[model samples]
Target: MASAAITLAAEAPKLSSANTGFMLIASALVLIMTPGLAFFYGGMVRVKSTLNMLMMSFISMGIVTILWVLYGFSLAFGTNNSLIGWDSDWFGLRKIGLTELWPGYTIPIFVFMIFQMMFAIITPALISGALADRVKFSAWALFVALWLTVVYVPIAHWVWGADGWAFKLGVIDFAGGTAVHINAGAGALGVILVIGKRVGFKKDPMRPHSLPLVMLGAGLLWFGWFGFNAGSWLGNDDGVGALMFVNTQVATAAAMLAWLAYEKIRHGAFTTLGAASGAVAGLVAITPSGGAVSPIGAIAVGAIAGVACAAAVGLKYKFGFDDSLDVVGVHMVGGIIGSLLIGFFATGKGQSTATGVFYGDHSFTQLWKQCAGVGAVLAYSLIASAVLAFLLDKTIGMRVTEDEEISGIDQAEHAETAYDFSGAGGGVVGTAVSALAGAESKKVDA
Candidate 1:
């Protein structure tokens, strides 16, 4: 009877329908973030470049999805060679058994693949904010392909793969402060250096065209982020997923308040843009630490990141690099701050056991490990992204013509505009009566 029972237990399916259902919902939530990003970036640009900004993000969704299916999943999560991964079975997401589970986890291999696919989709979309209003749509798309192949995939393996160096070294990235945010931020810096700034960058106002849209995007991103952060655990068998969810909310709230405070003191008002950007800054910072830190630590992480990112955004003007939308300031800096804080704030409680400077035996072991992972990803992504951008710039040309820059990127590149201006001599709404009069005087317009 004992032998028969052992055999039956061994043969029972490892798949967890509960976990699978959780991941599917999580994947759908993460997918919405790209459109949220589109609205966020879309609202930041002038009306002239609105569609171009949005398409830059939307194109990444299209491009990365194809690449992930073809070779991205295999190369990123397959058998690790320390620096990268490969497995022909996962090539084109093929040949795995219908019920095959992902090694140690109860979820099916396909569920894991799709969840990670959402990550690949948004990482490139994040970089588009840095290049807004200037880049050719085709060049940006091609660069997304190249950058994914070279930079994002490898870093993801390094930070998350079972046998990768960072993972083996005990680097504790609960989600993706290193793999996603830092990688995207450094990559943005590289491309901007190669492509240069938007025309009349510092001279032009370039304020976000629609704060309401930015707020909507921020709301969507915040909503989607629960899946992005909590779902990283891949299952709710343990209670870590709940902890991560709470931390995400805590840190994000602290960050929003901290940012508003900073701007109120420095810029003399609490700006909506500051609130939105701050919340995201908190999200980016806590992403790596949420699974490990207590909620109090989460507040510290969020507040620090919010204030730091707010200050860092102004550094572009002081240093004279056009990050268009402060990708480097918020993402890069926020990721770094969150990662390094792990060295000090880690309590050795949850998903990761490595305690930080403030906890454990007070040793810096985990801190050093975090530093190694952060530096490696940041340096590699920056250098490789710059090379890709340079090659694309030299070959197909990255920026639209100067005429396009002044005329409007939407019409120049996409041949479409965000709003209609065909009121025939109305110009820009002289008055309610004048607008009606002009419409009546002119032929009907589309």
Candidate 2:
């Protein structure tokens, strides 16, 4: 009996191959989301600015990856203090061995690093949508580098880090509601205020050039989000990952339908753009709460986010802010809804142990905590991003010249065009028509 007891105690220390494989695949899935975001945002812009939109997202993948490898991972995941981490021993991953697991988790420390790296890459990419078609490429690149270091690194430490104040206060951000979506959303709003409106703003029509591409991008985002939401569990020991997976799907579907339904009632036309936007809204709302809410709860969250975000998008026009691609409306508003709803809908059975008011916890404590997380991140991102944009604007300038604005940004900035209007000099038909015209002119002259 004594020997059997000792063996059972030792078994828990062994690495889990199954969990490792799942996380490896999950990391790959999440990595693809950045390009998917590229396509999604790329298709939403006018054709003249398409490539710039795509590059903005793709560049974040490169920039954040290097930053994460150097010290970002350490600052985010290291244990040091309540507000932000300060351990440099794991810098460049020198201290962590490949064979060693992450603390008590089944996966290697490297696997966890790459998985989190994907999240860090996509967060700044999300902000690109709001600043499309206006800012200089160099300034934008610099902003990405600066924003990630000042705003993202610390907020991520606060929300997801081991000793983060939010984490210690019982706030439940299962994935990245406060850290990623809210942070990016508020950051976008701040920069938009500093940069001012796009030249056309509401005066000219800036319709999406390709609906098909938008749909394709949205499809990819939906597919990859499974890994993003479910894989946050870090392991599959208790089947909670499966629950998160189902919740993600159900919520997305519900939100898409809700958006379409609202469009039909208000606009009299159900648009493909509306559908794609609705799906993303649902995904954003469920991201933080998927592990805590039931499928029914997910449906409610999706429906609410779909309607709220759909309505919120129009606020740019009403309130007069140039959120070029609805990032403020969809991501910021949806993230807030998801984070706060946890106070009302949390079941306290899956990933988080805290129950909501509806679940019979009978207190507003969780709601207050959620508010703190959302408020702090939003306020900090807004002020910090504004200062960064203002400084860059005053020093190096942010916008292109007026002539560049009238001409397409592709030609003005990159010296290339997404579409070439120049045709072949002349085809066989053109040659025949020219010869006949010359014969007629000669006959008339004679």
Candidate 3:
């Protein structure tokens, strides 16, 4: 009996180590999706603000990385509170040093923390795309900092934290259907309402400068998404994780085909933008249900999401609210579609959990639960985002001067240009003059 027990104990450690290693790799894969987002948004904008839009996402990598290490992690995942997390002994990486805390897996708690950190960083950056080319850089930077602290941290705690109310309520968000997509989409609407439309939103053509760039961005996003969905499982289990991976790919492809077909029927030509947008719409929709639904269910979800998001994009024009980049239409609508559809598509085998409406367990209860969850997130995000935007607009001001906006923020704020072909270029000349004046002022002070 003693010899058998010793063998079992030895095997257990190996299994645990394998699980930890898988989680770490999956998390790293998710981190790469942020830069994919940067390229996607960058390609959608005009050349003048291409670099600015990309910078916004890159900056999050820096800001959120630091904040997560400090207290953001504590506020988000520390406790099971409804409102927010209290600073317990676990605050500021205290519990991280204790190896025993990483239960059920071999990897360190620190690895888990960093993996989640990437998601926290990228969500706000996605919202920034909706208000491109108008807001002051300093203000945008400050807004995300404050928003992450007050808004994101609390919501993440409510949804994914250890003792979160949403978790207790059994709300299913395998990835971030509500926490990331709906939250960012609602926040985009709030800020755009306060800042007003770009200078010539309706009047100017504002065509995308490069379709190829958009395609490149889309490819990256799709590639990185495997990590996003499968990584959520945080284990090497072939059952759930493998299902999620296949669902993600199928849905994306289905959405792409649907979008292109719709565009061809409606418009004269099948544009690349339609294909990329459709794929992303499907990806967003599948995120919430990837782990819960079957492959066939994923196809249905993607097809509906693609069509719905395509139609929803036009609402901005009809309603006269400037979403700028269609963040509300794609992310918000797709998220809702996935969240609700999962109710009808969920299934369970012999040892699995609950099944959905279509699996012979036809009932409205699951659908109703999904609706309630969607409504709660929409209401909370809309109100909180509006309040935050209003306060920021009243205090520091949300937009740049009209003249500064027309000139482009790169020149007005940073005093540099994104591209400079001329040797000792115009930007260099301008910088030299400004430096000379600053030196003169310093000499006077001395």
Candidate 4:
């Protein structure tokens, strides 16, 4: 009887295997988003620095992927106190093999580590859009590496880790409204302040080189976002997972329609770029609230995000901050809208229990909490990012020379062009030397 029981137990399907498989697939979906971001930002930049813009995101994947495996995951998810994780014993994922600490499931710790690593990779890359076309690639790389160490890992630990201070404080970030979007948006502002605006900020026409690429990137982002939002469930549950899935779709669609409608009324045309941008804004808005809100709430969130982002994007002209790709407008404003609105919309007892000043909860407790979270994230990210950018600027220099700015970083720094239709014989190395020679000759002529 004992032998027969042991055989049956060995043959039975393991729950951990299923969880691990789902996590790995989800992680893969999320990883695709970095390249998706490449196309998204690439299309928005001038044709001259298209590849350089894309390279910023692509290289983040390479750099952060390695760092996450080495010590990032440990600092983020390791069993340590709240402020920051130590790399003493669990330096290279050594202790992860011994136990599965995440509750309610039995997946390998490595799977969870890899999944979170993807988030760490893309968050900083999102800021690259704001500083596009001017910053030196090497300096940008150094800045992100330091920023992740100083800013991202600690905040992630605070919000998501077991012993995190925010978790203890009951700051409910379902999937990184504060950690990812708010953090990236605030950081973008800091980096832009330090790096300065693009060469022709107000004057350059700076139209998207390819609307199709924008749409494609948007599609990929939308597809990957399902996993991003839904997989936060960390298990196959019908209630929260289903809610997240529906909310993600509703909010995105609503936002897209609202953006197009606004554009038609204001500009007399509904651009494909508007559609894509609206979808992204909606997705960002829904990300923090998808698990907590209902379908109707999602629709409202999406519509508001669409119109709000459209209006907010124009703030660059008014407030005069050159967020080159609308990072502050779409991400910062959209994040605030979603985070605050969720206070009113998260209903219960058929009466909106946690309602904002609107449906009771009149003390505005939830709204205050939401605002506090947003403010904290913004302040921390802004200060930390500014310090890191300053350090990099002082040590390695941030922006390229004005000559390099006009000539394009693809040829000057990377020595390669995004498109080589002219049958240029030289690769990136040759282009760099030629560009440098041109700069020197111009200096001599002057």
**C-alpha TM-scores of all predictions:** 0.94, 0.93, 0.89, 0.88
**Considering TM-score, where higher is better, how would the candidates rank from best to worst?**
1, 2, 3, 4
Sort the candidates on lDDT, descending order.
1, 2, 4, 3
Query: Per-residue lDDT for 122-156 in model 2, tens only?
Result: 99999999988888888888889889889898999
lDDT of 4 by residue, 1-446 (tens): 99999998787544566666777788888889889999999988877789899999999998898888788988987658876666555577766654443544556666777788888988999999888789999888888888888899998887778887776665556667888988999999988887777777888777888888889888998998887877777755346766888899999999999999999999999999999999999999998877767788889999999999999999888877789888888887888788778677766422123445555667767777787777888899999998888888888899999879887778888998776543444899768767765675475357
* Clash pairs for candidate 3: 80-163, 346-356
RMSD in Å for model 4 = 5.7
Output the TM-score of candidate 1: 0.94
List all candidate RMSDs to the true structure: 3.8, 6.0, 6.6, 5.7
* Local accuracy of candidate 1 as per-residue lDDT tens digits, 1-446: 99999998898758899999999999999999999999988998887789998898898888999999899998888885988999998888779887899988889998999899999999999999999888998999899999999999999998888878898888888889999999999999999998998888889788888999999999999999999999999999879999999999999999999999999999999999999999999999999999888999999999999999999999999988999988999999999988888888888888867788888746688889889989998999999999999999999999998878877889889898786545344445546556664564362221
Worst 10 residues of 4 by lDDT: 348-357
Could you tell which candidate, 3 or 4, scores higher by lDDT? 4
Off by over 4 Å in 3: 1-15, 104-106, 349-352, 421-446
Model 2 misplaced regions, further than 4 Å: 1-12, 423-446
Q: What is the lDDT of candidate 1?
A: 0.90
What are the lDDT figures for the candidates, one per model? 0.90, 0.90, 0.79, 0.82
Task: Name the weakest run of 10 consecutive residues (lDDT summed) in model 3.
Answer: 417-426
